[model samples]
Target: MIEIENLRKEYARGGERVVACSVRELRIGRGEQVALRGRSGCGKTTLLNMIAGIVRPSSGRLAVAGTDLTPLGEAARDRFRGRHIGMVFQTFNLLQPFDALENVLLGAVFGGRDGRAAKSRAVELLEKVGLGDRLHHRPNELSVGQMQRVALCRALINGPELILADEPLGNQDPETGAEVLRMLLEIAREEDRTVVMVTHDPESARFMQREIDLTTLRDGEVAA
Candidate 1:
């Protein structure tokens, strides 16, 4: 569940304030899958980051799963995000030195789970994503699709209530992208998790229960 009211994010550039994203009101129900559609620089990613608590809004309210992120400090937000939100980034963001299982275990550890249980969950997730045999492989040793699957497992390892994916399929070929998206949606639905994905592709948007055009929520000029 996500609720937003007069949410606006701005950045200072060239000594002038520039709006990054603005949404007057938006609500997403629990267990819903929504796609945020927009062109480059239209604030899709900005909105996702704000919801993930990676970026603080300049004004207005943002509540995810009943927690108002607008008033929380960075440390508090980080802890909350770790425990309640799962993020799948386009870039994968996996540490090169850590193996696939380690990357996922780190997520559970960050969420304050016990080590043995975390490892078991990580292994289960990796197996669910068809990466059971690749647990010892580092990021560089895996293919693009495999890397993304690993990232997906990492995101789900903590059993987050909300999953935020930014350009999840941006880098893969059509076939691989479709497979990844299918797996993501299927997993989310099976787990009864709420998902909000940022994407510019119309075909990708069709997979979600609802598609929201970010430009429609704009209040002023937005930066790319």
Candidate 2:
């Protein structure tokens, strides 16, 4: 679940404060799958980052899963995010040096799980994503789609209650992207996880239970 009120994020650029995202009020229920839509530079990704606690807000309030992130320090936010949120970044964000299995295991470790006990789950996720034969491959050794699947596995290895995905299907071909999104939603439905995804594609938006146009919540100010 997510709740926001008068939330705004601004960045100092060219000696002036530029608003990145502003939402007067928004609420997403538990187990909901929502798609966030907006034009380029409209702050869709910024909103997702704020909800994940990776970016701090300049003003207003944000609460995810009953915890208010506005007052939490970076360290505390990191701990809370690790425990409650899973993120699928547009860039994949996989460490180049770590193999696929190691990359997924790192996610579990970051979430405070024991690496030894997490290995089986990591392998299972990789296998589920059709990466069983590439478990020992590094990022450079895999294709773009493969790397994306690995990132998905890492996000799910922690069994997070909320998943925040920014352009999750941005890099893959149509078939691969559809497959990836299908797996994500199927797993979320089975586990009862809340999902908020930013997407530009209309077909992708159709998969969500609800669609939100970020521009509609901007309150007359343009996002940078």
Candidate 3:
């Protein structure tokens, strides 16, 4: 579902150029779940952002669902992402002022589905994520688990083909994190969605079928 070749990202740290990722290649197939494991500052998030088309790599190419990401300009990349990519962050990132339903509806807006139907879809997603009862609650009024469920609803509202999660369960307590992860994987599997996740815990990484050691690729090279 996604391919990366000669991907590289560099950053300026302390006035010195540093390579964040120097992966030569990686491929994720449709309906597969891949886990990326690495230490802190191992460039996992950089790679995730690249796959999400939120970052422009210094070199190489990225293709998601067969579209060449590098060639598309930022605007086009964003449009394509809205159509195909769903992202979940460690922090819920929900808008505090908006209720769960409204936050999920925003996903529809990005996909140009802002209408009654869109709202209905959002409601359905919330229900799917077990957030139906909390639809009227704002982020500040919810627990971490509830907020995370809301984020999941928002991410899935637009029917994204590929799911990208960065440290998705890192912030939750062990029990809650397991529940959230189980919920996410079940839905993705049922929908036949491809998922790529960055995680620090080995236990969490084991949940996926494919295991990628980001440190090796970053320290040396990886090929798409």
Candidate 4:
């Protein structure tokens, strides 16, 4: 589902070059779940953002679902991401003014889908995530866990083929984090979508089928 070759990101800091991340080659197959594990400043989130097309690589190629992201313009990348990728961020990034269901519908709406059918899909996703009774609640009315669940629903409402989660469980307690991870994996498997998650917790990483330790990769190398 994802392929990267000679991926590298660098920055100019204090008149010196800083390598944020570099991956010589990497491939994540369809319907697979892979966890990217590394310490701070190891480029875990940098790589995730690159895959999401939110950040451009300084060099090399990144392809998702057969489309090379490197050459795509900003607008094209935005459309590509909205169409094929679902991202779950650590912040939950919900809309405060909108209710839970409305928030979920935003996912489909931004993906160029709207109307009754989109609403139905949003409702189904929210209910599936155990938010049926809380559908009318706004972001402020929900707990942290509830808010994250809503975020998950929002990410899946568009039926994306790839899911990118950046520190999905970093805010929750151990039990809640574990539960969320389980729900995420279960839903991804049921939908037959691939997942690439960035996580610090090894226990959480274990839930994925494969693990990529960024520290082990050379400055310009990525493990397959």
Candidate 5:
């Protein structure tokens, strides 16, 4: 499970402190799919980055899978996050030179495990996402939907309990976006992993079990 309490993020922008995200509380459980829906400047990405431990919170508590990551030193936090959290960026974040299979395998290596089992898992996931035939294709050769599936496989390669996806289908056409959304939820259900995603599309919000609007930043805190 993931527990976020009184989470606040303040940064020095120019000369004054700026609040990117100020959340009173939010909790996500295993096998649950939650979507954060809001406008562009509402801090969804900031919240996701905090969960990934890439950005530190100015004050508050964030615990994922029993680990309190808010206080860990930078290096320790990085290692802990690599072990417990897997993120799928809107950009796919694939290596330009690596093939699909190799790219998925690369994610597993970052999870700090031997690459062999991860490679095998990647194959199974690719097949699960209906991309078995394109295992060796490079990003340049794959369709937008295909690339998103490849990203999904990479995110799950490390066997993370919590999957954080930021606009998982942002760049795809309507048809491809719908397909990606379905596949994401299905895979999350089959694997019994927790998923929290942020998307701007209203249609996408309806697909989630529950939707939280971040547009109303209240009491100097956000809630779902």
Candidate 6:
């Protein structure tokens, strides 16, 4: 459900153009789970950001879920992304003052569909992620894993077509991480959505159906 052709991103660093990420052609089918692995600064996150419409590519084409994101304006991109992409950030980007349910409800609000049914779905997703009792709890009061679960719920509240998770299990113990990853995969499968996760952990990458090493992808180079 994702297609990229001649995609490249460059930024001016120290007055010099530095190529961040480049992929001549890449395709991910619907309902597939893929893991992107590489060392720090390998542009894994940059690629994800481009797919999420947070970053504009310097050149080439990008299409997600049949929508060509290259031509969309910022406001349009934001609206499209809000409806089609669910993102679980590495840092758990939750609002400090909002409770778990409210945070999840914001997903529907951003997608322009918030109402009674949306609120009910938010609660159901939070409960599905084992945070039923923590609905009223704010980010500061929740544990790291709990906060991450809440973030996942918020991401899924819109029933996005694609899920983008960056270092999804980066902060938890091994046991907890495994459990969380399994839960994530299970939910993704049940929803029949595409998942592209960025992680440095080899063990975590192995959980995915396919693994891509970003180090092997060079700027202007095509995937053979």
Q: Specify the highest-TM-score model's number.
A: 2
Global Cα lDDT for candidate 3: 0.83
- Residue 71 displacement (Å), model 6: 1.5
> Candidate 1's C-alpha lDDT?
0.88
Report clash pairs, candidate 3. Answer: 24-222, 24-223, 25-222, 25-223, 25-224, 26-224
What are the per-residue Cα lDDT tens digits for candidate 2 across 170-224? 8778887887888899999999999998888889889899999998889788744
Off by over 4 Å in 3: 219-224
- Scored by lDDT, model 4 comes in at 0.86
Residue 55's lDDT within candidate 3 is 89
- How would the candidate models be sorted by lDDT, starting from the highest? 2, 1, 6, 4, 3, 5
Residue 206, candidate 2: Cα error in Å is 1.2
**What C-alpha RMSD separates each model from the true structure?**
1.8, 1.3, 3.0, 3.1, 2.9, 2.8
Error of 4 at 19 (Å): 2.1
Worst 10 residues of 2 by lDDT: 215-224
Candidate 2 lDDT at 216 equals: 88
The better candidate by lDDT, 3 or 4, is 4
lDDT for each residue of candidate 4 in 41-154, tens digit (9 for 90 to 100): 778878888999988889998999999999988999999999999998878899999999999888888888889999988888777667789999999999887888888888
Q: List the residue pairs that clash in candidate 1.
A: 41-224
Q: Encode model 1's per-residue lDDT on 1-224: one tens digit a residue.
A: 89999999988988888888999999999999999887778788789999999999999999999898998999999998988999988788999999999999888888888588889989988887678899999999999878888888888888899999888787667776787788788988998999998887788889999999888888755564
Number of clashes in every candidate structure? 1, 0, 6, 3, 3, 0
Q: Provide the TM-score for each candidate, comma-separated.
A: 0.92, 0.95, 0.89, 0.89, 0.87, 0.92
Worst 10 residues of 1 by lDDT: 215-224
141-181 per-residue lDDT for model 5 (tens digits): 99877887789788888878889998888777888688778
| TM accuracy, model 1 | 0.92
- Which residue pairs does candidate 2 place in steric collision? none
Which residue pairs collide in model 6, if any? Answer: none
Which segments of candidate 4 are over 4 A away from where they belong? Answer: 218-224
